[model samples]
Target: MRRVVITGAGTINALGASVAETLEAMREGRCGIGRLDIRDVDRLTVQIGAQVRDYDEAAHFNRQQIALYDRFTQFALLAADEAIAQSGLTFEGPLAARAGVVMGTSGGGLNTQDENYRAVYEDGKNRVHPFVVPKLMNNAATSHVSMQHNLKGPSFTVATACASSNHAMGQAFQMIRAGMTDVMVTGGTEAMLCFGGVKAWEGLRVMSKDACRPFSATRNGMVQGEGAGMFVFEEYEHARARGAEILAEVAGFAMSSDASDIVMPSKQGASRAIAGAVSDAGIPLESVGYINAHGTGTAANDKTECAAVADVFGHHANDLMISSTKSMHGHLIGGTGAVELLACLMALRDGVVAPTIGYEEPDPECALDVVPNEAREARVDVALSNAFAFGGLNAVLALKRA
Candidate 1:
């Protein structure tokens, strides 16, 4: 099998607009969650979110492009642009034909849908935008990325809730490793902080009113976030031949399903995925020094994930440092794993462990070294990023220093 490596990374999230900016924020242990600035904020019970502050869509897109591209698609394109530019890859000839795109998004054009629904239902409008269907499709982000980058090979979107990005990236890694594609533009995007999006999540009663404090005794619930993360996954040899700057190696990936609950998480299933990823990487449990946990700041997810890690790593679990970036960036839902993967890359590339910000008091159930409230400098050779989503879907990716 061909070895895979990450050549480039990009993101536009609550933390920052570029990979450099985001990593700086992570190093500083900054908190991005705050009072959301969106339409109809007065109507929602949950008013806080990690919104992309000071975003100027007009600065990034023209009139026609803005008309066709939804907010999620815009974010994907911006991030993809940065990744492709950083990679120094101009897809053409066979590379263009072999390169592809795979992205994940839970609500594709949620903002568009919210606007149209309000116009039609609340205002009693008879007609909607002609491009509403195209804009709101779940595959719109993937399709747009493919079109923009000229990725003519296999392209698709994954929609496994919070695990969507991890699953999509896992598939991309497999395709490259299997020699089906030499390169893949893979990641995820989400712009679901609109009125309808918050309303739907509010019904679940799992949203925090102010902050997201993952793995903390004072934690209440998760705060919603919006953003996109894009990365360039290339064959190791191909990258080396071109003298590309490798960020980190995609060592292994595994996914599993609980087959039990919808909203609740299962420790057994999460452990299987976590253990499977390490086994797939052919790395011993002790080699992993850090983990970007899927600590959702919820009672069920935090405890369940801690138990799963304890079960998988056993005694070694206590030795490894684990932290949740969700507390800083909030939860981006489908785009979360992609963003959280940044923490893993930081561990391998810079030896900097991103902190589980907002952690005030420790919970007995989650008694691991969470790197709480402050960033830490450590020699991390291998790191894992965990994404256990709704409906019991779990995906874990293991990374090694390049």
Candidate 2:
């Protein structure tokens, strides 16, 4: 099988506008969750979110592009620019034909939909923007990234709720490993912190009003966040021939579904995916030193994920370090796993484990080394990223230090 590696990574999230800034924030256990600055904030019951602040669309895009690109698309484009630049691979000629894009997004162009809905329903406006359909589509980010990067082969979007990014990235890894593509621009982006977006989630009653404290006994619920995390997944030999700086190796990926619940997570399904990822990587459970958990700060999710991890690794589970960056960046929904993957890279390359900030009193049910409150330095050879979404869709990716 062809080996896959990540040559470049970029992100524009609540923590920072670039990968460097984000890693720094993670190292310091900085909290990005704050009072959301969006339209009609007064109407929202849960007003706090990890919003990408100080972002001016005009600064990054022209008037025409802004009109056509929604917030999510814009975020994806910005992240892609950074990732592609770092990879130092210009797609042209045969390379362009062999390279493609697969991005994940749950609420694509949600801001666009909210605006149009307000104009038509609330404001009594008759017509909406002509490009609304294309802009608001789920594949808008993938389509725009492919066009901009000249990726002509196999480009699409994946939407599996919270696991969307992991699933999309896992597919990208498989495509390269299968020799179907030489390169893939894969990750996820979401801009769902708008008025309508928050309002819709408020109905779920699973959102924290103040802060996100994953795995903590005092935790209320998960917090919403917005941003993008993009990466360049390239065939190992191809990247080596070009002398590209590999961030980490995409060792293995596994996915499973609970087939039982639409909202609650299943430990059995999560454990299968986790164990399958390690087995597929050809690595022992003891080799994995860190995990970027899908700890949503909710009661059911935290305990369930911990139990799944314990079940999969048994004795090794106690030795592993698990932390949720969600406590710092909030939950980016579909874009989350991509951003959380950055934490794995940090553990593998820089030996710094990002903390599960906002954790106060630990829950006995989640009795593991969560590396809470502060970042820790530990040499790690292999790391895993776990994403278990609402639909019981679980995706796990194993990464080895490059």
Candidate 3:
């Protein structure tokens, strides 16, 4: 078995295209969410989202590749490229065979699916795009990453609804720890800003009419978001031996399911996951510095998650700094865990906890140090990132400052 550490990280969301920009926005307590204007907001009750505006796909991909990739893959590939570049890795040497790619995405090629579905169903078209399979496949992003980088060790995709990214990263961590691979690119990508995709989520009737106020009494529901986040993970010895720039060490991970409801989440599931992760890391509960909560700003999620934390940590829950990044980037769904992981890493590295943007109104059920709409500077040794999905899937990962 080997130790795993993060060497590089990158992300593209409503906040910005890179980690630095995103962290800066979080530090300043900027809300990236706004009214949805891509098409129109005539029927949807909630008309706002944390949409990634002003991105040029051509700059990231060539004409041929651009035609084959959906919006989410484009974002994923771009983030992966930045991470690989920052890590200073090459396709030559043993790195080619030792490296792998792992990604999580809920609607892999939703934009492509919606377009082709409309063509075949609405227009009654005789023929559809021949490249649809390659474009719309859930594994397309992982396949493209392997092809682009010539990585042959392991390549796959994980789909666990909103917990997809965390599961992917956690799986990657286990693989590295067990010596399956030396280096891996793990993260998530999502593109649910499209009309059909957004409409599908609208059926749940949880869209925030105005904003996402996680842990707040006035909290309504989650807002749609689109983007990707990636991280380069390498075995600790391998990274140190090669003089790689170490960012943070992936300490522990745990996963569980409620097995009760599809939409409603459970505090017991959340409680078990936090305890499991803490136990897996071999760290006391008091060591956890900050938590990147799965605070969707929904009525059920905020309260349930709060109760779970309190149950697991007791008085330590009040002492810890917690925040919901979704208040700004909205919820990225399958790709959310990856972005939240970045928040965890940043918190551990800089010892500064980002705020839960748009947090207001005291919600007694969710009473905690939510870092309300303002970043706080503090000393942090370990950080936790949580992802609880709609189907009761929960994945938690802990990171130690390196």
Among these predictions, the greatest lDDT belongs to 2
lDDT of the structure predicted as candidate 3: 0.89
Q: Output the TM-score of candidate 1.
A: 0.99
TM-score of each: 0.99, 0.99, 0.98
Tens-digit lDDT track for model 3 on 154-176? 88999999999999999989989
Pairs that collide in candidate 3 are: none
lDDT of 1: 0.94
CA lDDT, every model vs. true structure: 0.94, 0.96, 0.89
lDDT of 3 at 199: 86
Model 2 accuracy (lDDT, Cα):
0.96
lDDT of 3 at 269: 95
Residue runs of model 2 more than 4 Å from their true location after superposition: none
Compose the digit string of candidate 1's lDDT tens values, residues 198-267.
Answer: 9999999998897899999998998999899999999999999999999999999999999999999999
